[model samples]
Target: MKVLPIFLLLFYMALDGLHAKELPSNGNDEVIFPITELQIYADERGFVNFSDVLNGEVEFVISEDFQPKDYSVDSYYWIRFPLHLNNIESKQWLIEFYDQTIDVIEAYIPTLDGSYKKITMGDHYPFYQKSFDHKNFEIQIDPKLHGEIVYYFRVKSHTYADIRIAVRSINRFIEYSLFEYFLYGLFYGMIFIIILYNLLMFIAIREVKYLYYTFYIFSVGLYATCVDGIAYQYLWPNSPQWNQIAHGVFLFSLIFWAMVFGHRFLNVKNSAPRLHKAIWAVIFARVLLFIYAIVFDNSLFEYRNIEILPLSLIFYTGVYVLVRGYRPARFFVMAYGLLFLGFLIKALLNISVIPFSIVSYYSLHICFLMEMLFLSYALSDRVRILKSNRDRAMQRIILQHKENVKLKDKVNRELERLVDKRTTEIQEKNIMLEEANQKLNQQTAEISKINSILDLDNWKLKNNIKEILQDRLINKNLTLEEFNKIFPDEVSCFRFLDRLKWENGYSCSKCANTKYNDGQQKYSRRCTRCGYDESVTSNTVFHKIKFPIEKAFYILYLTNNRQNKYTLDELSEMLSLRRNTVWNFKKKIEQAFSDKEDSHLIITDLFSYHINKKVS
Candidate 1:
């Protein structure tokens, strides 16, 4: 059995060697083959068959007699070759040939008409110059290959030669096409997610920072896709107009985002003035470049070159600010650094210093993604810092509130002390006022008692004078002098009585009635009120009392002014009577005056007058 396998292997090697050296021939500027019929068969018996000439027939025909007689051998050779295989594990095959005399031989494969390959031939005897055209080829079997498989072969006029070529070009095209599609889908998907995420952030934060970041991410995505040729080849194949415009759009967007993001990230206003000025200059340059691109389309390349200058300027400025401990500057430096590296790599590739391949094409986009991730972290850090600042402000407010509360408490206590002091002072003043009022009331009562006593004494004296006048009137012949002598203790009383008798009514005693009153001799009443009366004694003690009538009328006044024992002795001398008789008359008059003072009528009238005066 082993010998059988060895003999089969040797036979296979010899057949392969023979096939390797076989070459098709052309006659009369045309090529022909000895075997014309070809067929392929396969069955379930694990066997495959290729029959080029059925029934061992070598019957083939070539009609080359119609060729022009002047045609050269190089001009007329034409051939068709068909290849088929069964039970073939390889998707590609090789054909070989050799030629001895011809310095150059051309072979053509019709199945792969649009394809070209070079073949070399080796020297062999009989000057066996071989040429391959359509006539010498035949299909023996159709080989089964997966995925866009086709069969084609080349022939050469050589004794031995080797052909090495791929027979499945269709599969490679399909694989590359799918791979590029996948990359495009993946890139766009990431861009979509970035847009959605940034949109959400903008809504939640209501911050222009988020808006700038969104545009930055969109510009980055466009730049990456354009650099990769994905946008031109797959996304918009027929829109060359869009492709040309995309370049300027991408550049403009990039610069705009850089300017906006730089301002937000660096807090340019708070930075050093020179640094801030430099940043503004970069922004101005970007604007000039954008405007230049719009006004002059041919300046787009110049704009792109100018953009790099500003980018570098912004990047270094941001680095400076960041190193100076500007909080936002740190994020800007990191993000711009990533973008700058990406752009640097892409620029180098575009200038052809670097090979155009997958790694070079995707390097910039990957860097951009890294930049975005870093920026997100920076934004999160900024949010944390803002929150911390807000919390500190709130704490300050709370502290201020606490201080206000303490101040209010102190003020309230002070006000309460003032109120208490004021209340105590008012209470003390009220007590003092009450004591003063009590003293005033007691003084007023004592004054009222003294006035009542004086009024009662006055009334009693008046009544006593009136009683003496009535006694004299009853004794019609009694002269004023006699009456005064009898009642010397009441001399004023006697004078007042004489005046009452002379006058119809009481009159002034100091100025006596004169003129007609003195001339009247009739015994009619005569005074200021009436004419003078002859019965009225002008020099009698009654008319000429030592004291005034008002003072002398009161008994207490007489007693208080006169000497002791004068009531009776003085009255007897003035009246011309005995001392005992004068004494008895004086005593009786004093008793009547004292008795009248104690009467209820006098006391009641004095009290009533005092009460009426108080009411009025």
Candidate 2:
């Protein structure tokens, strides 16, 4: 029980030693102190008033360790630093937080009237709202160090709470900022050169890869500027909200364009399909984190936590490219390695894992510059490789074209030889075809002569039959040629028909009257006794015949002589009449001879009643 009490006393003593921190007291006009030497207490609810801390109601514990603080917490952190000055006169002092992204900073300083004068400064407020017109958060302290001088800082942030506090003389602040800005100027100059160079390349080549890389470089450069206080100082001095989220916006943009550059630079889609898909997944993750940051404006640190997985995957993408024999990734890996080292050292320094120093503080900038230089070299090398590949492709095309020309020449020669052979064979076949055609024509002419002789013999046989069977008037059996010569026209045929029908005089069929006068119609006659009218064809087999009279006479002559039994087609052709007219006239002639049935009437006998009658 006595041993446990001794251990408890020792533990309490150790705790006291850890919480005690004292500033150096010297009669100096200017001095600087880091945040490590301060006492800190986190006010979870921020309900503790300054009066409570001053009235011993709340105790201030020492800050975590003698290093920088770089972690995010929801609670408000109250940092107390004890200042000891041995001067009786009032001296100028400054307390500044080097990190620019802190959201709110409240400083409680003890005044001569035994009360605290509060000063607020942060990027969350406008740059002009800061107590001093400086890029970083700072408060001026002019105090007489007689009894006790303590400064309380209430710090809050949406991102990493990098509690990098610096107490300095006013003059020291000016000198430090000048040096810092100078380094920033150099860093930005290099980035500008790279951006301009690549932009020109993009314009000259019109390559999408160069364009993507140009934007990636611009985003990275903008992100670096935002991380530093230069953007807040100069770019948008009045825009506190933009200053607050600028880091997240540029960071997400950098991530997106960097992945796009990687995908194009590595030719991943064509070379490594699976890796290309993984790159897209990383890009999607970046977008989600960006969206989350926008939704929860105060949860940027939480968004960063989600971003780690994709960032790690992006690193692994470089490794995958290297393993897959991607040539560009050699430089890619080197550049990323340097960048990773710089960011790691800076992170370690911010978290107090490594002591804060000038080199460690600007490690990210140094690494970024080196990375940009190496990447520019890599892009140049990529252009060289592409040009070389293009030249080789052109050479291959030219060689293939030459071979095609040779093959085409060989094919043309073979086609010419084949054409000559085909021509000779065609000529021989044409000569043999000509001989066969001549023999066929000779046989055709001989058959034509034999056909003509057979037709003449048939005609002579028809005449012989006509002489033996028909009347003597048509017994001469005029051929179609002789009939056409004797009665070549309609008038001659009409005269012949009149002589055949009314050889003695005109007659009327209605009353068997012999005497007739001229009727109104040219071929009609009117009877003087009975007033009956008659025409040359009105009462004969030719009655009501609308065809030419010459064709009727030839049909009668052919029928009387029995030279030929004409079908409608044959009669129409022989008499030059329509088939229907010939059929009708033949029907009327056959009907006229119907009373003499079974008595084969000759053409003259069939119409003798009309021809021989004289009613006078």
Predicted model with the maximum lDDT: 2
Model 2 misplacement above 4 A: 1-32, 63-72, 86-92, 112-114, 143-148, 296-301, 340-360, 389-616
lDDT of each: 0.50, 0.70
Q: Which model scores highest in TM-score?
A: 2
TM-score of each: 0.42, 0.57
Compose the digit string of candidate 1's lDDT tens values, residues 1-616.
0112344434433433422221222211112222112111112232211122211222222333222221232321222223332233433233322111122333332122222233322221111222322111112122332212122222332111111221222233345447866866776787778778878999997988888888988887776665554555446545544554565678678777876777776676677677677777767776776777676763364234456676787788788777887675566678889878877876675454665455765777777777787777788788888899899999999999999999999999999999999999999999999999999999999999999999999888766665554433332333335423433444434443454454564343545544334335223244555444443434332244444333232322233233333555664565456777545444644665566764334322332332233323
Output the TM-score of candidate 2. 0.57
Can you give the lDDT of residue 485 in candidate 1?
46
* Worst ten in a row by lDDT for model 1: 132-141
lDDT of 2 at 428: 100
The sequence of per-residue lDDT tens digits that candidate 2 reaches over residues 1-616 is 0112344434433444544333334644344455555567777787986656554567765544544353445778777766554455444667778778888988886565545677778888888878777777887766554433556778887666667666666666787778877877888888888888888988997988778978888888888878887888888988998777777788778767777887787777887788788889778766776777788654563343343455456567787878977777778777767766776676566566887677887787788888888888888877777789899999999999999999999999999999999999999999999999999999999999999999999888766655443343334455667566656787655665666677666556788777778877665688898877777777667767777777777676665555455677977886677888877776666676676664345445633332223110
